[model samples]
Target: MYGLMINELKNVLVAFICTWGLQLLTGITVRNPLTLLYFALFWILGRCKKNEKYDDKKGKMADILWGAASIILSGSVTFFIGRKAVLGFDSGLFRLVGILIIFAGMFLVFVRLKDLPSLIKNIFSKDYSFLAVKGMMQEEKSRKELPFSDLKVLGISAVICFLCYLPYFLYEYPGIMTADSLVQYEQIIGVTPWSNHHPVAHTLVISFFYKLGLAVTGDINKAISFYTVAQMIFMSLCCGAVVLRVKRIVGGIVAPVLSLIFFALVPFNAVFAVTLWKDVPFAGIVMLTGCLLVDMAQKDRGVWSDLIMLFVLLVLLSLFRSNGWYAFLLCIPFMLYFYRDNLIKIAVMVAASVLAVIIIKGPVMTSAGVIQPDFTESLSLPLQQVARVLVNDRALSDEDMELITDVIDTTYIHELYAPDFADNIKELVRAGHPEVIENNKGTYLGLWLTLFAKYPADYIKAWFDLVGGYVYTDFPYDVGNVDGIMANDHGLVPTPLIGGKAVIKGKEILIKLGSFVPIYGMLWCAGAYTWLVIFALIAVLKNGRNKKLAVIMILQAAMIATLLVAAPVIDFRYEYAVVMLMPLTVSICVIIKSEKTAKEY
Candidate 1:
């Protein structure tokens, strides 16, 4: 027990040092560099002692003493550098006390090093192999010859999906209206000019349903009410599609039922459905594409229906989100590799998708009078760096400042630039200097590259602040607020179609509960994304029979890569597709094991 405690203590110290050391590198915080350096030395010496052939109590004691001395040295260095007493003690006296604490720590380690090697061996030994092997054996014994049909699961889940969604739809009767939805509705009703700033395809779809509602009932409110109900049904069908795919992978009813409960009761999915965002249907389509991809892989000869679904899904996915098209382009090579045997079909699909993009984005959009998205949206990171450098008053040569001025009004960037987000800076840049950007792409690119070379640290810090939410859990930016996007705004007057103040308050409570509840909160956090990546990697590596699931990872990775470059800010909605798809990815890895995997079990 004594040796085990020491080993655990060492592990904790290593983790602490690594965590803070990384923060220091990311510019999240500042730390005494010497402290990190000494901890690294301590870890090294401890590992060396562990590998020694014979007991060396004296050497272990000496090593602990060295670590203690290094800590005291670091404290003295901190005092000299800052010329401030640590915790009210003089620098000299602080080092003296710190040295004493280190010595006490050393003595504890000296006492425990006798059995340290054996304790560590016991901790990391291969004894757990039997557990894995035994579990596999039991699974093999219990394995069914044929899996149950997924039809019942799908039917039950769809009913649950609708029933679970009813309360939210009722509470926010017409809809959980958002600013984006309002803008889209206004465009449809001729209150504002139609533009393709949001996807033209989604807007056209909304216009069709909304107009149908208006024609049938003659009341715009009733139209909205009908539209909301229609959205709920569409989203419920999406939930059913996901359940069907999951059922196939897991080969059981329990997992699908649990998934149904997760979707049925989880406030986020309900809120997502009720709130109309381009990302909502985009997420649905992405999942459908994944299901089709899996289905194609399961077949020896690819089905024509499956090929048609992929082609249509790729087109819809591209139109819904601007980056969707790019993500599809990135995934194509992998898709072809996965379907190497069906090259002709895959080739035709790609050629057709390319042609569709040209026609839809060019002539079709031109006829519809939808303006193309601004080019600056694709340049979020560079703009962030420029604004941050201007804010920090970082060293910029006179010529460099001139080049930047040609691209943006540098004077107002300091006032408008948000330190941890890129949206405000983006607006400032695009609005302030439209003419220069419209004409001078090469010059701006050159200036950006030169400034990056000059203030590399500021550049890195700026980017980390923007996109660090994906990798760092404690990233200070709050990008997951669905309230603004889902606020119950239904014109100036209150009506039955409008969600009243009480319903809005209830929605707020649900959001908080979804964020703080034990398992539920995981769905809302950036930390969950880190685990999703880890699990996806495990699935890709472990499930040899179904390596096609790695396509999901490929698509997810493409999205993340796009986020690094194009995300206006680290908003959770931007990565929602990845988060919502995790269950299926993990199920494919763990439950859909190959016959060889079953033998090992």
Candidate 2:
């Protein structure tokens, strides 16, 4: 017992040291104490003897060495692939290297056969037996006979979600509460008008109704009405799909009910469902994709259909917002790591999708704009800047950080940053505005260099801070009102009372009570923390060892991390999909646990 305790302590120490090292190396700042607490738990459990049997010193040594090597190799391969692609080389070499490293790592981790009694004992120990039993029971219950009428329950849930958002679609009272939504709407108009910046799937969907409404009344307002109604209908459909998917995965009436409550109660969902914002569509698409991917990964069926659907969804997500591309990139590592068996097919699908995107949205389709250059010419520089900020020992002022972020966002020197370059090249091809395009590119390049030369540390600090902020803040914080006491032009309501009063009137109302409520405002945070605990426990206990589910959990967690690092700026609207997923995943875990427990008895 003393030895076991000592080992556990060592594990905890390792986890803490590793986590701190990662924070320093990556320049990530985890603001939430809960996140850190979870990490600590993860480290201790991950190193527990029952979870991992490293009986032989030689084997343990090998495990450590190989694990480190595999990680390094994977990183190196990814870097080479990115570099080769950026440098206009045939990226196939790096792709091959990446594939080889991935396979090698998998073999090192899971392929070696071990048949020791201790290993078997470790796999089915009493410590984990309860969890296993719970998982089994849940699986069995989910598989049990179900009444046909339950399908109707899903429909009802969908209706409820739809009706909840009907008011926004039906009426338009301009106020401060709706300001963000209006800004998004205006942004859409600026980009794609009528068709808007919504995911192509959503915009196409709205366009269909708008055209129909046009034929009936030929009025923009009526067309907008049709668009709004379609959004509500589609959102309802998304909710229904979520309910059905959760029901199938978890089983029981409780699962669906809980899922409904969780999604329904979120203020973001309620408010944004009616407003014409891209978040609803983005959430719907991501949720649908997540459900499909989970089903495909877990069930081992519908591979082809799921892949096709995923492709379509990816295109829609990408077109919805630039950030959608991150979702697509995320899938690559997941497939490589967890679905290695389906690599060839997944690769084909991914390649085809990429080709389609390039062909459709490539320079050929849109008129190229003039190129601009800035001081942050190399990608490495921005990354270095990020590293500096993350590792900064001193405290930073809000203004200093904000200035750094603005610079980083504009001149990261990536292809995506060259917004005007394509336009310029197109004009040059047409012999129109050639000088303007060249000059624009020079101007951008010069500005980027100036920033790099003048404020390198500040630039780096901003990059890290931005990434850190995203990783840490599960909820939106008022940037203009840091310390939760100041007010600025960013237009966040000055106080809960004022913001609520502007939206809802009545002196007796508790306008921002949800912010303080345990189950309301903090639900997402709680759910996230709970998921980490449950997932780590399950992985340790060897309960419900479904690789697909594990992969999904890992991917979701990683995506959240990536989003934090890459695009930390989140509104309630932006995080709605993630918010909804938390409760759903937790409910599934609970069902699995309960069922497994019941079986044990």
Candidate 3:
């Protein structure tokens, strides 16, 4: 392992040398150094373990050359296949195919095509044995099943979870809220137009509870309070369900007890439970789904009931967030492979989920008069390009200026152009510009390309500035106290909530501790999540059952990649799903590893 680590560092050093060598030759400074570091880190984490196994067999030079070749091949393939999508895909078909190709190529290289036959044979074997698949199966079978279900563990854990958030619930009574709630609530109250932008599925949930509250008590505020309580109940139950499942697998009261504290008492998570946001409910459901996935990963054979529940959760997951569908897209392929024993069942579920999304988001949403979101949301890179060009004060002819103005109004670019954010520019164009961006995409593409060719460094700088938060640790603290605060200017009734100063101070202190703490800070930053994903990948490559749970890391990687191209800002809420899953994930991995070690003894 030490030798393998040394080789990986040597590969990175070679890449670093070649990087500066190119800069010297071309006199063009690298645009996104973090991006390079990110890719190298990803490569190291994923491939280093495999290198360790092969180190004694392969010569040092062979190891170095192989690593370098792997890096070049992966990068070149991605650049060539994804270039069109980078400019912009005219059809969803192109983007979907491009992503599929990328993942396929990635799997082929990462798994080594030379071993394909053995891998497939192992997967299809009566008891899949590759990466200790059969060992995990044996462990599952050897475990004694309890004669009766223990509802007490569930009850106790749920109560603990509820109590953890009680302080926030009491302090911020009804909820720690935000402006987005009011925007979403307007549609539920029938005072504003309905739209899929806020996701009608979640809006309908709020509306049902609101009307239910009114029918019972005739007080709207009571409904808000009920809604907040309902969120807490749901989250608590989900956390409890996951803990119970873990307890069943590991056969310990202590680990389960500690798991409860981690889930219920973690500062950010505890505060997050009472905050009324669409993400809260979405995250709660995601946790429930994760439990189901974890159960499925441990068992040797198929369970029809669990499959049905997983299908339901995946559908709900895709519905609650706009980006949820993308995450699902990245997961389904792996699900097929991981559950290869139940190919037909997995296929049916995936197909049904996809069809449901198409029908609901297309015809159902359209019938309800849900206007499509702005085009600029999808054009983050292009918008950043325009902003960068404007910031440079580049000299342009009248025709060039006119061409740019035809796509985006250049007047607001000066004030709205924040290198680290795309929302300001996106909002400017959505407010004033015409919706001919798709129609005149060629012209827009030409302008973007011309600017890129002219000021590559500036474009690179903008990309890094916007995306560095996810890949680098020092990219400014942007996700501060977004929860536990209400929008004051939106004319919503003033919250009766008081003494929030104390709560705010508490949150600020937690954030600072997370940011500055030496070893513990990995739980806090965007870059830390990147490392978590990397660690999960290493765990997956080392074991196949681990792969079942760790495959979600692919979704994490894809989500982060999407953010690099499309996110408006670096918000912690964006990666909250990862935060919620990390503890449970580590616990499961540790338990399984301990079991394996005991068996070895």
Candidate topping TM-score:
1
Per-model root-mean-square deviation over C-alphas: 10.0, 18.0, 15.2
Error of 3 at 503 (Å): 6.6
lDDT string, candidate 3, 256-341, tens digits: 77678777866667667777678788877777877778778777777878878887888888888877778888788888987787
lDDT of 1: 0.67
What TM-scores do the predictions have?
0.75, 0.55, 0.70
State the displacement of the C-alpha of residue 586, model 3, in Å, after optimal TM-score superposition: 1.5
Candidate 2 residue-wise lDDT at 62: 79
* Local accuracy of candidate 1 as per-residue lDDT tens digits, 1-601: 1344456467546534433323222333222233334344444445544445535888768667766765565445444432332233335764455344333434333433443554456458843231233443354345442244567666667778888878676665566556778788878878777777788788888788888988999887667767667777877777777788877777545556666776777777787776668887888788778778778878887778888878899999889888888998898898888777888888898779878987999898889777887877777888888777889988878888777777676666777887667778778777677668668888888988888898899998988888877665544333334543243344512144437688777767677654322234456665456557666766675755666667887887777778877777767777777766766776676554544556665
Q: What would the per-residue lDDT of candidate 2 be over residues 395-507, giving only the tens digit for each residue?
A: 54555445434433323233332221222222222232333324455553454455556567666555544443334444334211111112223332212222344334321
Comparison by lDDT, 1 against 3, better one: 1
**Please, what's the RMSD in Å of model 2?**
18.0
Top lDDT hit: 1
Every candidate's lDDT: 0.67, 0.50, 0.66
The list of candidate 1 runs beyond 4 A from truth reads 1-121, 129-133, 136-149, 476-507, 541-543, 592-597
| lDDT winner between candidates 2 and 3 | 3
TM-score of 3: 0.70
List the candidates ranked by TM-score, beginning with the highest. 1, 3, 2
